[model samples]
Target: MAKLSPKNLHCELVVTVDEKINPHIMRDRNTGQIYADDDYLYRLKLRSEKRVIECDGLRYLDHSLTVDEEGNQELVLRGSCPSGERTEVEVVHRFSIPVRGRYIEERITIVNCGKDRYYLEDMRFGFRRGLCPAYEPGQLADDISRFRLVAVPYRKVGISQDKGSPSPGARPSVKRQEYTMEDMIEGKFSNVDWRNDETVVGQDLVDRYRLRSEGWAWTDGRCGLLIVKYNDEMIEYSLVERNGYSRRECLVFGGAGFALYREPRPASVLEPQTKVSFGPTRYIFFDGGWKKAFYLFRDFMAEKGHGLPDGYNPPVNWNVLYDIGWYHSDREKLFKHYNLEALHREARKARDLGCELLYLDPGWEVCEGTTLWDEERLGRVEDLVRTLKEEFGLELGYRTIGRVYRDEFPNEWYIQRSKEKGQYIRPIGSDGKPIGFWEPCTECREWWEEKLRRILGITGEGVKFMMFDEFDWRGPCFNPSHGHPVPSTPEGHVRAVYRLIEEVRRRCPEVLV
Candidate 1:
């Protein structure tokens, strides 16, 4: 067992590691509490329900903090699970609890070591039992009655208009939820992806409805367990709070939600010699109640070593993404007679409402595909920026469905152009045509140049902030043209986007993405 107390960490952790065995049950010093621990460390069924992985039986080989190219150190643990056959599969787990930070984040990776091809149905990393559920004088049982909060970034309810060029027809009113336990448990609740219906949970919702990248928070009112999920990939987590095993309050079991699906959306295959992993589900144990959970999560995010947003502080300064229509334009509201005036009013309204910035989404583009502002149809971007800042004294922000729109300007211009510079493009299709208009290959040189130019251009034009929405870029570009393997992947795409965003900061050091 090895203990780690990263610098300035208000807390310390004890990890139980043994040769030929994965680390289990890491307890904190204050509460003697354990999370993502060994009690049920390797809980997912690998091939089938009967073939669940027994990590305690697996062989632990190495654990170290490897320095990434940027010279930052990362904690990584490696182990192997025997298939009860010829080849041994390697399991790589990367994790860390930052100095004085409140979360224990560990990503999952399974590599095929042997020559035999592997097929895995589902894999869940953490079993969600016994994770900081406390009891008090309340009549409710501690386990079943403890609170669980799920943060829905955007839950559309009805039609609505928001700060934008105003397309009322396109904007849907979002019913942002303050979810109680019932609302979450009743939703399509399977956190694990494969063979979901096979479990006691019936087919509750479609694949999209599953809501993989959910922000899950659990607390017994004293200490709390909040998992900040950043993507809809392998980091998905399940939260069940109902009458079940162990706890009279409720049994809240969760594992890493990152599972691979086959027919609809696919999870990565555990083929021999291939590698796949995702974690870093940020969690925190703060000194407060459920009311402050969201606030706490936001503060801890900057500390998780992921880059912080511009002026990344909390009571997160306020933006307009979730309160109303996700910044979509209502064509009727946007191009109408009161277009510019309406924007002026909205900007003033946001300012008066105490918002620091007004977020405009999906409307100002000349067409859905073009990044150029629709000056002719919706007035000049320069005028809008001046009004928002000069008149309203609020920062100007904007976003599009994806960075590059396909409706007008095909991705080909950037794709072909970038490719000429030995850059890569993410073809929207398996057809290999480099014609994915809706999706830009961030790996391509054009993507980087255009983003930098666009950021600087918009910032220079008085825009201070941006969200490259709909950039849920697909992984590890299989485009060998992108300098990756022939079989491109989601990871590659993610890295490319990260690089571009970093470049955006370097060039427009003041602009926020």
Candidate 2:
């Protein structure tokens, strides 16, 4: 006898059966009469019955063995309902793609049985990466992170147009009509794709791989197709809603959802229609080796009959800082008054309380200065960095709001740009209208690049990290210096900031770059 290896297991099945039925009855037990209509009949006796056949006694007609030729076992299960209207369900499952040197897969299926029309409201499939849960909420604070589910769709309702608009030859020309999902899909929706992945940490080293496609579904009277993938020991599900290959828009429906967890006991009896819910599903991808998982899962899904959108890039892990203090005044104040010395002393008291970085909030600079170092209060910036590094074994970081002090650096390019754009320094009034005495310039790329370069040079001596403050406050650039008056959308603005960070990384690659 040979020991069963974890990698070579698979399950597949196909079920066919009779229709299911459900019965609804109204009875008068005391009168010994079943009433079809109690008010209308003097004395009525009626009996009605209906039959329902749900998923029952459907065993795997195929092999349930754990090992197969494809490095994993495949399971295909099929069944049918015997109600007046017959319906069939086909379930295909692939199990045991290796992750952290283990193989696993779990699949489930539900078929419509009741007389009432059934809707495929939502579908969810989930699995554990290793012996442990995939990820916790706290792990998401860093740049490179792993998540359980990568992408899910948000449901959007379509708006219809009115039919009373004037014709082109009428007195006034009508406005161009707003497009529909069909129109957009035909015109713009093309070359889309779905990619997903997961990573598992091991005792000695991390192991990862691309998840292969596990199963897929095509339902009657439904406008879209749903596909599921069990890859890299994680689940990847994609719903592509389109009209043939002609045109389609990927609509992501936003609402509460759930992921099925492993039941404590498979044989435990349960009631039907149990309510379940899950947390907010964010579309995020893994970093490093985990990206391969996404590619693999995407390929598997395409193979399972889901159409890949043209040129769709699966979300990848990118460095993003959601500066909480930028929007919240209280958070800003808390960070400002944070006791660094006390924190350092307390950290030394505990064996596990040490941080490599000490983030300083805004207001470190003298409210009246233009230089990087606030000479009056913070003293020399270099001295502070040295003290933090030497005493607490931590690197110091500071925030910059990109404001220039006219009295100090009187020849700043931003001031000139502001004047050219006809922008005035509005005084911070009680009404929050005219806010304070600093020149505001359109965020020209050249201006920001030059500013970052100067700041980097000044802080290059000792400072290790830099936090760009008030990033959200800097609105879209509309001046001639910006090279274009077109407003920068949120996505464009985020990309620009990322580019700036990349430049900073390039400049300071070794100093914890």
Q: Which digits, one per residue and each the tens of the lDDT, describe model 1 over residues 1-513?
A: 554333123333334456554444444455544443333345333552234454334556777765455433357777776455533567777766554455666566677776555555444455434322234213433343455454432222343343346564564545533454544444434333322112112233333333343455555566666666554443343433332223322333343543223211234356656776554555566555555676765565555655555767422134443333332334554466335555566666687777877776656665453566767665777777776678777777777444443433334423332223443344433344544344455666555566556556655676677676566543323334445444444455566667766776676666677
Query: Model 1, which residues run further than 4 Å from truth?
Result: 1-79, 83-86, 92-121, 128-215, 227-277, 281-288, 305-368, 372-513
TM-score of each: 0.51, 0.34
Task: Put down candidate 2 lDDT per residue, 384-492, tens digits, no spaces.
Answer: 6677667757666655654443433323333332324553443344455643335433245665666567667646767666666544323334455554434333334
lDDT of each: 0.50, 0.33
Model 1 superposed RMSD (Cα): 10.5
